[model samples]
Target: MPSADGGTTSLPPIPLALGGDDPCTAASKRTAERASWAQKSLSLPHAWKLSQGEGITVAVVGTGVSVDAPALEGRVTAVGDAGDDCVGHGTFIAGLIAAAQSKGTDFQGVAPAARVLGVRGTDERGTASVGLIAAGIRTAVDRGAQVVSVASALTTGKEELTGAVRYATKRDVLVVAPVAPDGETRPTDAPVDTYWPASAPGVLSVAGVAANGTVLRSADGAGEADLAAPGGAVVGIGPRGAGHFIAAGSSAATAFTAGAAALVRAYNPDLTAAETAKRLISSGPPTGDAARLDPYAAISVVTDGTRSPASAPEESKPLKLPVMSSTLQDRAMVVAGGMAMLVLLVAAAAVVIPRGRARGWRRP
Candidate 1:
């Protein structure tokens, strides 16, 4: 078991794969007792006052989602055997998007009330292919998903994935995906470049960022991203237990953006898919190449499908104070006392001098 904060109770890291031919991810035995940094950074409670993504359905197109995950109970509808998450990655991603608050932990999804639809974009072992992901996109759209979160990012499959995105676009469904695969799945020698589906015209390609607001090094060469969200050291639920597992990558960031999209759709039911995307992008605080995802601003800020001043990155002005050394303070106090004495003398002179002038003629 993996240890965290020098404690044995913390959950182990979720495996992307076993690292061999036909590799599969293993199940985690422990659960994290605390909430993730992403949860605190998002401040979802403020956003929830306006919308909890109550009526929206976000599809998790990945290895699969566990039907019995405690936080996601009664909210997941799986397509075929997609309900069984052997790798646990899909369940983690789904938890980030729509898990409800539970009794034991402070962790909660971005959109707690939104529904989840599970579709397998990767095989049971977490292996992904162009055909499988493309088919999953189409299936999610067919199942009436308002927003689709794709977990896989491939260098190839431009044609098939592009077609799938176009199909979703025409049907007015928003698609969110990572700019590249997570560090675990990406090969060390792979060049940083645009990946398919994310490179497609209508998809919202998201990049991962650490708590410090820097883009994850794993996503450095993945080209420009449409937006950035917290993905590093993220915590979420496993396939079967209430325990939380930690993972990182652009896929986790994509889940956050997808949940924001759901919140936008839920609050502004009349906005088109493109408009909703515009709101998310426009409302975010621009951080270099990609805007940082701000779920509250996405729903609360007023915009005309364009960047608003409320969402612009505020220039950080330094707080300035007067130099007050001990020497200067003492001098200031002396000067103030001198000025007070002068005023008192002037008042005395004004009264005495006038009386003396009047008495000069009387000698009284």
Candidate 2:
């Protein structure tokens, strides 16, 4: 079984004097309450104004998420008797995608109102076989998940997984998978073509980027990297509501992208899965280091049929009257008359200067 890393390498150090009113505790709480930088970078707030992924069901397939996590309180639903999670990687991804503000903190998920289906494809140790993961994908899709997020990438391409991907695609369910982060420490050195599920046809492969919108050094170059999103220095809820921890990897980036996809679906229920993916591609920034997600742009394209969403009305405003053709024609005539006068002056100057010079008849 290949071990999937959820990327939560370390949890921030906790202060010894932990109290609700303690300064350190208060500071930590404040940071946790603030919306994540990834969400802000993706313009999720503006996107939220259009849609909160209200009717979309996002399936998180990986290590099990803590269904009881405070931030995930009402949004998580477990499928079958999936095993418990010890690594908490799945929980963090869940939090990134759908966590809501809790305990006086303000850090809300990208699609805070979207529902999550937690499918425990991996064991307690966070390792799973190709078959298990493939099963998880199909189960999520079969259970009515509009978006299935597979947080792990494997080198060994399994027939079951490929079939599952095609199954989801044919059903118009968006399947998102992470491209293995590139580097010496990458989980698999497998060729990009062999990145199972991610390389599968119709699956959207995501890459990781830092706060400055630069692709991480460990980013996966395989799967053609469909899109990139903020992944570095990510803060998310820990297992069983322990607290928030920082993580980095393509897994987090995939979660963010999945949330963006959910927003598009929620904004326009009429958009087919293919149309939603196209909306994201059309709004996504250039790929690789400069690739950045624009959730508002993507949502607007689907909701308003434009590249950018029209600004919201401020205060009580009256609609302005449309400009009339007569007004436009008058302006055009004024401009034409000015140009005509300028041409006349220039012609007169040309004639007068040459005549004056000729009359002088002196090589001054």
Q: Which candidate wins on lDDT? A: 1
Model 2 / residue 62 / CA error / Å: 0.4
User: How big is the positional error of residue 6 in model 2, measured in Å on the Cα after superposition?
Assistant: 21
Q: What lDDT does each candidate get?
A: 0.85, 0.71
Candidate 2: residue pairs that collide: 33-105, 33-106, 33-107, 182-218, 182-219
Candidate that scores best on TM-score: 1
Local lDDT at 228 for model 1: 90
Give candidate 2 regions above 4 Å deviation. 1-10, 13-33, 181-184, 188-193, 289-291, 302-364
Candidate 1, residues 218-331, lDDT tens digits: the string is 787687787899988788878876777888889999999899999999999998887788788878888878888999999999765363211433454567988899999999
Query: What value does the lDDT take at residue 314 in candidate 2?
Result: 29
- Give candidates' CA RMSD values in order: 9.8, 11.4
lDDT of 1 at 244: 75
The sequence of per-residue lDDT tens digits that candidate 2 reaches over residues 1-364 is 1111233233453221123433312112213545556766777778889988898999999877666677778778887644244557777788788887776665677888999998976765666568878989989989999998888888875677889888998999999887764332556444444567777777877788777776766664454577788776677776565366666778888898888889889988998777776677657667553246788888885322322111121243466986779989899999999999999999999998899888885666
